[model samples]
Target: MIDLLKEKQAVLDVQPAQSGASFAPVLPVDIEARAVSKRFGDTPIFSDVSFRLARGEATALVGANGTGKSTLLRCLMGLIPTSGGSVHLLGQQANTATGRELRNMRAQVGLVSQKHNLVPRLSVLSNVVHGLLGRRPGMRHWSQALAPQSSRDAAMQALERVGLADFANRRADRLSGGQSQRVAIARAIVSAPKVLFADEPCASLDPSAGEDVMELFFQLVRDEAVTVVFTSHNIEHALKYGDRVLGLAQGRIQLDATAASLSAAELRGLYD
Candidate 1:
């Protein structure tokens, strides 16, 4: 699957020039979730979940259905309030950051979920360009048929990253399930995010397409040194693709270990 994706390579990114002589410094830890917990009134979602992902590292959350994997990702990304503890991204407390500070922090993060979350009637390029809405405002996002040339060019580059440049003019709803998911990925990464959150990114595709999407997702993030925290029902993909594997069950992290140290059977046992 990875080989196939590699064969269909397209342009990936465009970045501003930096100092020619500056040394590359090691990036700090990208995500820090300390004893994070979530609940709905009296019902517990998950409890005391603590973990960290260094820059460019990937961690996969695995458990049975209704185990709060998605909810935890939301908490880390500041989309929802955690019942207890805190999540820090890029050294700022996610729950405490306020106003423009919070917006700036979130602008550097991205999410790709099971749902493509694209506007059906919009062209694929327009949907991907929506990612820049964080960086550009005051323009009508929904009503604009054509974005600024720079935004369109960037969005096209993003589509190329996902092997969908040729489909840029196609209506989003016209694409297949796998293509839609890839478009979602392009939209998420178009902003050059420092961290990305994905929830079951390949759950809706067939085995082959699912693997290809996962590989593409991983490659794009790794190429730009984006930290990733994703949840997956496929234990094998989690173990094979993630540097660290975390098992959540019965409202807590039952197991946490390097992916290389844990077998698929051990991770699967958390579901039972």
Candidate 2:
């Protein structure tokens, strides 16, 4: 299955740039979650979970299943209301932001989930171009396309970064799982978002593919200065790729440390 995806990806036209580019934030973010908590009726997910992601840093959220990792991501994105405390993104309160405020805030962050979330019938290029939806809301349809040439050019360039530019004309559903994930990464980064949130980005991939995807993510972080926050179940990958790892258990952060400083015993204790 992986080999087939790689073959289908061969058709993509990746347009490498003359020189790599960097994304410097106009105002750097000190993302902080202060005493945040969440609950579903009688079930509590977290209590007083606090942490911060300094600008230009990559943080890995690691935990066993059903530990509220996804819920925390949604909370950071303001998709759901928090039961207590607050989430600050780029210094803006996430939970209380209004519709327009939320939209503006969301424009600064890009999300890539385990699911590609692409329209199956849409062309790969079209799906990538949809990354501009937050920027060009007026051009909602393929027929009514109004994105500037620069935006399209950027999207194509992003595809190239992920090595999938040639698949631009193919339907999204035709690509393999790995290829689709690559496309999703391109879409997330094309917008030059200040923060990139990836939820279990390599969850469905085999070991090799998972490493490749994680390497690509780190490359983006180093090359583009895009702050990344991702959830991962793999402890080795977290230690290898993450500058810092936050281990979550029972809705709260159990261990937060630099990868080099984290020991196997400490990591094992996080799950206990």
Candidate 3:
């Protein structure tokens, strides 16, 4: 029965960039959560959530609003402490890493939040150049005027990939919402980090612009083999863009399966 469904749906996006490559098993679990939990004071946001992903894979996180999707992402990134259990990132323990070790671990990953997170006064190029802060970590790369020519070049190359190089010198405040999101994506990919996390990156844009951004995003990251984990409310997107689908509902992972192994109807059921 599962084989018949798989043949009927024609799943998309597992190994999207390299269509010829087989959907191999996820081994080595570069990112993992073991019985993780989160709370705000006495209010438990979630409990006992756990999953794992391999390098170069893409997973889509979906759940009803207030299910703690964003909070869970932060925990995995080591931005906040988990209430209980453990998270492993790049073979390093997330909760116990020292200050320097924590910084080093974060440097290997990228994040594109729902908000653009760009400095309004800075130029578009400068915002993208900030992606290198994880690697550069100094006053030198703070702005285009102070950054070395090499950094500027790398920033420009990233903008070019997103087709935004011409706007490199424009003030970030002047761009439209869609354009701002594109710059955000450029910033996320500029470092070519091993992992990328996006929290509803296109939620603010119109449908057309959002579609374009998602396409451009997948194209760039998959080409670089950057492992991706993004949260989205769109069910079709979960089915279409992720190698795996993880559904969070009632404060736990209610569904865990490959995109190809699941159908849109199955995902929608998780919402209620």
**Best of the candidates, lDDT:** 3
Stretches of candidate 3 off by over 4 Å are 1-26
TM, every model: 0.87, 0.86, 0.90
Candidates in order have lDDT scores of 0.84, 0.81, 0.88
Question: Candidate 2 versus the native: TM-score?
Answer: 0.86
Model 3 lDDT tens row, 1-272:
33333343354324356466677554667799999999999999999988888988899999889999999999989999999999999999897787999999999999987799999999999999999999889998899889999999999999999999999999999999889999999998888789899999889889998999899899988898888899999888888899998888888877777898777877777775
Predicted structure 2: lDDT: 0.81
lDDT of 3 at 251: 82
Off by over 4 Å in 2: 1-28, 140-146
For all predictions, the C-alpha RMSD in Å is 9.9, 11.9, 5.5
Enumerate residue pairs that collide in model 3.
Answer: none
Per-prediction backbone clash count:
0, 6, 0
Write model 1 residue lDDT over 1-272, tens digit each, in one string.
Answer: 22222232221123356868786786588888898889999999998888777898899998899999888888888888889999999889997788898889999999999888999998888888888887775464442365777778788899999999999889998999999999999999988999899999998899999999999999898898788999999999999889987777888877667788667766767777
Candidate 2 residue-wise lDDT, 147-247, digit = tens: 57777788889999999989988899999988999999888888789888899999988888888988987898679777888898888878887888887
Q: Please say which candidate is ahead in lDDT: 1 or 2.
A: 1
Best by the TM-score measure: 3
